[model samples]
Target: MPDTRQPVAARRTHCPYCALQCGTRISGTRADAVTVEPADFPVNRGRLCQKGWTAPGLLAAPDRLAAPLVRGRSGRLLTATWDSALQAAAEGLARVRDAHGADALAVFGGGGLTNEKAYLLGKFARLALGTSNIDYNGRFCMSSAAAAGNAAFGLDRGLPFPVTDLSRARTVLLAGANVAETMPPLMQHLHQARLVVVDPRRSATAHRAALHLQPAPGTDLALALGMLHVVITEGRLDTAYIGRRTTGFEALAGRAAGWWPERTEAVTGVPAADLRTAVDLLTQSGDCYVLTGRGVEQHRQGTATAAAFINLALALGLPGTPSGGYGCLTGQGNGQGGREHGQKSDQLPGYRSLSDPADRAHVARVWRVPVGRLPGPGLRAYELLDALGEEQGPRALLVMGSNPVVSAPHAARITARLAALDFLVVADFVPSDTARLADVVLPVTQWAEEEGTMTNLEGRVLRRRALLDPPPPVRSDLHVLHGIAVRLGEPPEHYPTEPRKVFEELAAASEGGRADYSGITYDRLDAGESLFWPCPATPDPHPGTPRLFLDRFAHPDGRARFADVEHDGPAEDTGAAYPVHATTGRVLTHYQSGAQTRRVPELAAVAPEAFVEVHPDTAARSGLADGDLARVVSARGGMTARVRLDPTLRPDTVFVPFHFSGDGRANLFTHPALDPLSGMPEFKVSAVRLEPLPE
Candidate 1:
């Protein structure tokens, strides 16, 4: 009866979920329920996670906003035509700009957007709106690693090489990444390597590791320096590599000498014997990789921790090798590409700093604007939100593809400040919690219904093709942004209608810059050839690049710099009132903020509610039984959630997944203090206490 004999057309694309960017095939038409199947692409071969497999269900969700909506005078949201919606949004922004200058308005973006959208948003913020108060959700995700990598190596791609290369490695040191829960398929490759996982808790990945180094929450730098001390003092350092391929070795080694294992053990919970074993594994491996994640990057010493990781890698001659290097495991699908395309406040396209005159001139020319019009880097996310309710606060904001109320630090404060804004606009497929506060909400197309490109965790640029037509009245993000720019009197040539043309302009802006992408084109990507970035000016038609820096470094001296890092505690330390150290992270079942995944019935059925993970001892002490509601309280806020006693967690620590909101908003309790250099909030560690919720 349903035409079962008809062959469904196959639409090839990348998963819209995590940074894994596994290939997927959309089977069936928009009229019928579509099914997502794993494609046999090089990245994941044929593996699909629960999120990826059910990604298409989001398209048909009943709650999806199919038409633009405006908050009427009655304080109720009602459907409005596109023209009316755009006009209202433009007038509000223009009024704010006229009254308080452009700096009084702000724009926030996210890593989930395509490169075209990211570039246009940055362009609109700087050129159309004439504002320097532009930032993004990346301020919470990758700014720290980006800052450290730029300081040390002049580049910051998540993996500077392909993730599959890890299979060839003999030793893989996972400094703070929980690969088993975040990207489970990656464990298949890590299985062969001598795994070394470092974290305060014995995470799932750490439990499977050859060695687990449980350090105090903020003492990762100390343990890293201590390991480096052993390597240098015991003559295990690769002297030839140090002499020929790196600078600042003496300074780094001198800093390490003061961090002896015995001293480090006193600060960190890890013992000296375990530290020796971890270093020995690194020294003996034919090929080794040093990896860091948000655990190491979301702290006061974030940049220092990243630098220490790079120092250890350079000391071992890891960079520029196929399976050997220092990798920062990025969290978002477009985290790698987002930073390269000027989404960051301090950067331009191609990861060029705005302070550089040549970089400034290059971008100014690309955007056809005077260099003077392009203001310098703006405030980071946390700082921007903190400025929201002040007398000199940003009065208007444009939020694209992010739900910061749940994701940003200090949830209650951010929500209160955002409510005070004179105007707020949000462009998204769904009316997220943050969107609910918006004066204007624009309906944008979802990933499976849009055509663009995304760079994965490994820096592999791949095509994301549209499988279904957008619902009537909904439009692509590019279309919405372009309309707004045109309405604001931007030249027609400056605002292109097609996404491909915009991407080409973005690529041209990046040409000859640090993160060179001159070689990438829509034509090549459509031909099913994936390539790592810094793809040369001359095109290589054969599947782009699988690895980078095989022969050279991006630094001017052709060597990576090693930075000296010391021990520093978290922004908020555990104390008598808040004795437990609570960390926030993602669960395999839910993606960031539980936006689209939570809408899927099957996925929601499996993981229907949020829960706090506590050690059995902690549960017993707090009188919290398994599945009982427990109140997690901090100095700033508190929330009630079901409790699960996890054996893997340490007795002194607890874990909370940052996907739920409202009464269970984990970010409400997260400290707002940020790493000065990276601007990343301390999401991984905070001070809190737990109690059994009374019936």
Candidate 2:
């Protein structure tokens, strides 16, 4: 068993990496770096990943942004004073607003930002700039799961129950999530649990599973339907649960009617026998969960795939139960909270819809603005970025925390669109590729040097305490946005520089909304006691809802929903020209864009650069070998990456880590096709051909 200690040290904080948000302590601080020790936080039980241990290297990184940068008359970014930079930024944004109207001033945020920053960023876009064009990079993470969760459960918190509940489960049917590589700290929870993993590649997590169902890329929906088909044919489903707890069973049954085991095998390339075995493992256990991540959520039919999984879980009497259900493994550090607090295209402060009159009225009262003053739904992340420089699109962009050049699907085109922008400003702690392209770059404080709250994958809210002040001239993201808002004449009171105060206002705005955090405060979180949301502001605050749908879902009908979903396959079809299916993921040593992790000497030494993973059979066919330079090509673009042959991968598929930029960015060849409902780009499946680059 893990140490599982509660935080007893000074300056206890969460990791600055993925959504695991492991507890950490600032063990020591020096002029050059901050040392870290694992804290006994509940999530990880005092464990930290390599990236977390060396996260402080970024604080003292040689190239870390410390001053403002402006594109001077000579066409080069030159260091400038805060006043001059703010003046230039204000003048540029004002010019764009005057020429193209408010909608032209778009804001793009990141999932890594704290709840306070995310809330303020959205408020800044609508209340200050008064633009309807605002979204965040989180759209690329698992927005499909979010859409599916809302459609089925009427609410979308990454997990309906706390992650600790997984430890109590007898089985976990994990799909497409490489928890071993991406979130190793979470593996402890599954140490004693039987596992069933689904993926095209034998991912690290899949390799540890009792059963690994290797499906073809982008065919998760078909596989899910097949499992449901088995559960239906074998009488493993609970008809009573289906009738009482959920609706739309007949619709899903009608759709699953045609997806028999044989048909599913042909479509997904998973053996029919193996599929039945997977169903057996799931049905054999009273406590079992079905979870998914970006692999199954980054396709053109991502929402449909997610819905199919929910239908399967609900049919098996899993959801709304004690220790078994479906959940989405949220990616970015603050991906869960970031989406909850209004940075999403269609949401208000509490995951409330923009079109909902009551939601708008409540949030408007918090902002002290008219209900109608808030902008309506804007373009999703991909659409907003793709629409830049168009005739009727955004002319100026304000980016906070996100480094999209290396992270967006079809990043080459995104970079082109960004280049065409009349004006661009990026706020970051480092001078990333995206920041370098900005007309102005503002330096900001990093995670350890900031104070805020983050909601983890379990929907538990945890506090991030400030350890030390950033080097002089480095401001927090809240401060940067506040400065820009003040320059634009927005009142100072509305945009507080203090994180706790911003969170207080955010809580008020979130009152009565779906993801209510109105009752939670920094005071309640003082003793390392994290709270859940939907915590209504009562005299004695609710202990935050750790489990949802036990009594009722957020649906007006007081029941969970199931969708009649069909498999549409991948948006891009494989052909003779681009015969191989290419998929991308992250490496253990690097976070989303490698902006901070890449700067760390230890992490950089472990995984110095990007590489493509190919099966031995595919490598033989292409006359390629391990450690060889290869060019993966698609109609959109091509990227040259070093090849790492893995027998665990499917022969017709190749994998690349999407961390590095420039010549090695995997997003260069990814398809830009968006899911019809969610507008999430198909980053998981793409038609591509490969060739060896001569040594």
Candidate 3:
């Protein structure tokens, strides 16, 4: 093991990938000459994932953008000064708004943005651009879980307790989350627990489980319902806790009453005996946890699926205690914070509703603007992207911190919509696939060159200290936003370029809402205080809330509500024509879109490109062999990948990592069917067919 002792002059910060946000220290003054060592953080202790250890490579990547680029009259991107690029972007956006309407301008954001950046981007879209069309890629990440958590508990903070609390759990139920690969450091907390994994693929996490329930794709809802049915039938309901701390138990029980093990097994493809075993492990526990990830929450009924699991947790009386609870394994680094601030289409800072009169009034006062000037809620991420350049949609767009070209569902469709736009601007440190399509690409500072605060999956806000200065001609996203706001007729004071000032404004804006951060200051964070949120300021230096709902749920009556959720199968079902299910996820070596990790030679050499995970039985049935190039075609599009046979995977299911670009992009085949409540696109399961491609 490497020495973890703090080196003199080393800057303390957090990882740039994943919500673990493992504490890290960099010990060099230059971007390319830095070495990263793990710090003693509560979440990951002193361990860092491969992606976190090799993150500095992103700073010195050979393809790092050095200067702004603008499309000239010849329709080609050429080097341009910051002044000219900002001018072109501002004027183009203004032209669209003047010709069509304020709604003709849109902004797309990402989950990786800092709290300050997320706050300012939402403010810029509303007060500066005077448009309501703003949403981030987090809608695609965990909106379903957010919606369900809000409905059931009246609040959502990913995990309601510090990640360290999981170490004492006797039973840990990981539904659709592969923590062993996605977040290896997190496995430290689960080693003492009796693990139960639910996934179609025998992921690395599943392999470690005492019991693995391999249900068919899109049947997670049914599996959860089956577990609840067993719990109720076996008389394991926590009646005292339920009567005291919950409502709607009878309705929820009635909904699950019909889903006996046999019926559930027929739909979910899990044996009735195995379902009973899962229930036994969960109920016999001293402390238990139920956590859901993207696998179950990316379906058309994503919200309902999450609520079903929440019902199970409540029935078991697991939540609201110090020992165990229900939570969502948030994917992105700032996914929890990005959506809490004003980045989501229907939200304002503090997780306030956009259409709420009181929420509008409070935020308007914070911005020093009239409440009447605040536009109503706009379209969600997929809706906004699908409507790009259409007569009824925004003609111009500004994208920051996301690469939708390879990440969005139905890539072919999103690509066409992007091409149809009148003007496009992308702010990024690297020439990502999305940046190559922009009318103006503004080179921006990366994680190591910027200082800000990011709230991790556990809801702890950590300070990100800059280790080195950015290269010449490259600017920070805050500076770029301030420039554009000034060019578009907003005062410089309204849009501060400094991260501290922006955070101060954010604190005020989020002072009274659900995910309040008013009491959290840079002083407390920099002083190494562990601050989880809903930390209100007016309460006279209140201690930060590391554990939530210890006494009561975040509801008016202080009782959790059990959702009457039911199982609705996949949006698209398998048939003779398309008889297989295809799923997408991340590999250990890469993250969303492969924007940074792919640049690291060490990571790329380990998992250089995308490949399809096929069971040997399925391969032989399709007349394909291992290492053969095959085309996986769905109703929307097709992507080619090398076939790797894995006997552990379900025979009817094929898995592909959604990190590569071009013909290897997994999202090309992902269906755009959205959950009615959360607007989360169905990314977990799609009906697809496989065809052999000759070498």
Best candidate (score: lDDT):
3
lDDT of 2 at 471: 67
The residue-level lDDT of candidate 3 at 204 comes to 93
Best by TM-score: 3
User: Higher TM-score: candidate 1 or 3?
Assistant: 3
Estimate candidate 2's alpha-carbon lDDT, on a 0 to 1 scale: 0.89
TM-score quality measure for candidate 1:
0.97
Tell me the deviation in Å of residue 336 in model 2: 0.9
Worst 10 residues of 3 by lDDT: 1-10
Stronger candidate by lDDT (2 vs 3): 3
TM-score of each: 0.97, 0.98, 0.98
**Cα TM-score of candidate 2:** 0.98
How well is each residue in 1-695 modelled by candidate 2, as lDDT tens digits?
11123433468888888998998888445443467889887779878888888887876688878699999988899999988888888889989998889999999999989999999999999988999888999999979999999999999999889888888888888888999989998998888878999988888898799999988899999999999999998899889998898888987888888989999999999999998999889888688999999988998999999888889899998888885889999999899999988898899999889989989999999999888889999999999999998898899999998998998988888999999999999998788999989999998988877899998898888899877767678788888888888889899888999999999999998988889999898999886556887788998767889998987878999889989888988987899999999998877898898888889999999888778899998998988999999999999999998889899899989998898878888999999999988888999989998899986
- Candidate 1 residue-wise lDDT, 1-695, digit = tens: 12233435788998887788888888776666788888887667788777887888887778889789999999988889999999888888999989998888899999988888888888888888888888888788887888888777777788887877887888999988897878777787787899999988778888898999998787898899999989988889888977887788998888888988899899887899999999999988687999999888988778888888888889988887754888899988888888788778888888778888999999999998889989988888889988874689799999998999899888999999899999999998888999999999999988877888888888888788886677778888888878888788888688775888988898889888877777888888887667778775664343445666666566887877888667777887888999998888887778888888888888888877778999898899888888999888899898778899888787888888898878787998888878889888888888999988865
**lDDT, residue 453, candidate 3:** 95
**Whole-model alpha-carbon lDDT for candidate 3:** 0.93
